[model samples]
Target: MASLGQMAAQSDMVQGLNAGLRRVPPWVLYLAGAGWAGWLFYLAATGGLGVEPIEALEHRYGELALQLIVVGLAVTPLRRHLGVNLMPFRRAIGVLTFFFVLAHFLVWAILDVQTLSAVWADILERPYVTIGMGGFLLLLPLAVTSNNWSVRKLGGAAWRRVHKLVYPAAVLGAVHYVWLAKGFQIEPLVYLGLILVLLALRSRPKATRLAR
Candidate 1:
């Protein structure tokens, strides 16, 4: 158990951290994420991302989208359990996740598949592609409504209910990754396991809730 003074210090530190976070606007993340994505594209174009630059770029963007999804899912748990608040940045994180997902799809459709018919064919014939496309479609509505105007128009409870699409979207993303990987690769499985664990944590009530 922590002493009163130690606990007080920790509380002060968290407050200070949150205060500093508030000073940073969410648009900062938007600019940084866009810049990073552009840099990755530049690297791929310049042959700096290995021999299979297009494939590498697609993987990078897809993996980054997954990471952002995980981070978005983590915000509530972190605030509820660890006393760390990231609510201010959750919308930005979500928007970036959608952006990266779109980028990943564009890379696959234009660079990898290279044909409209073949792209549609893959989505129909390939299970992984089908699943990934489903995830993307699910995110599309959420992304479109990720604004104050939509919230005001839809109302709060309705907005939240629609946003719950993220839950299944996230699971589909992990499953798509696992299905897309070759052989018995552990990396994709690790991502799937992490996503499942995060979902489970999100579903479970916090100690404070139980106390109530």
Candidate 2:
């Protein structure tokens, strides 16, 4: 446990940090996300992503989506425990996460599979792909409703309840990554463990309202 003085100092530091964050618009994240995605795509196209550029690009996008999911989940806990508020950027993070997820799917479907029928077959036959698709489907509704108008229409309680879909979707995503790995790799397991820990943290009594 932190002493009162230490906690106060931490709080002061967090306030300063959040003040800096406030000066930056959330749309900046969207622009950065778009630029990063374009850069990755360019790398894949120009042989910068190595021999198996398509696979690399697909994996990169999926990994980014997963990382962003982790970030989105962390915002609440960070604010509650450390007073490091990130509420303003959470929505942008979520939307960008979905964009990366969609990019991952497109790269796999268009560049790797190269056929609509094959993509369908993979979704049905491959357990990992099936899990990933399920995660994507869950996020779809959340993404659609991630707006002020939807919040107004659904009511706060209903909107929060619907957004809870992220929990299961995150689990499915981690599981998908674990299953998709060629062998007993440690990296996917680390992501799964991190996600599980974050989810466990969320199960605790809420010190603050969750940010969308």
**Best-fitting candidate, measured by lDDT?**
1
- lDDT by candidate, in order shown: 0.94, 0.93
Worst 10 residues of 2 by lDDT: 203-212
Tell me the TM-score of each prediction against the true structure.
0.94, 0.93
Give the Å shift of residue 101 in candidate 1: 0.3
lDDT of 1 by residue, 122-209 (tens): 9999999999999999999999999999999999999999998999999999999999877999988887888888888876685558
Candidate 2 regions off by >4 Å?
1-5, 206-212
Off by over 4 Å in 1: 206-212
Candidate 2 collision pairs: none
Pairing residues by index, what is the TM-score of model 1?
0.94
Per-model tally of clashing residue pairs: 0, 0
**For residue 133, what is the lDDT in candidate 2?**
98
Q: Cα deviation in Å at residue 16, candidate 1? A: 2.2
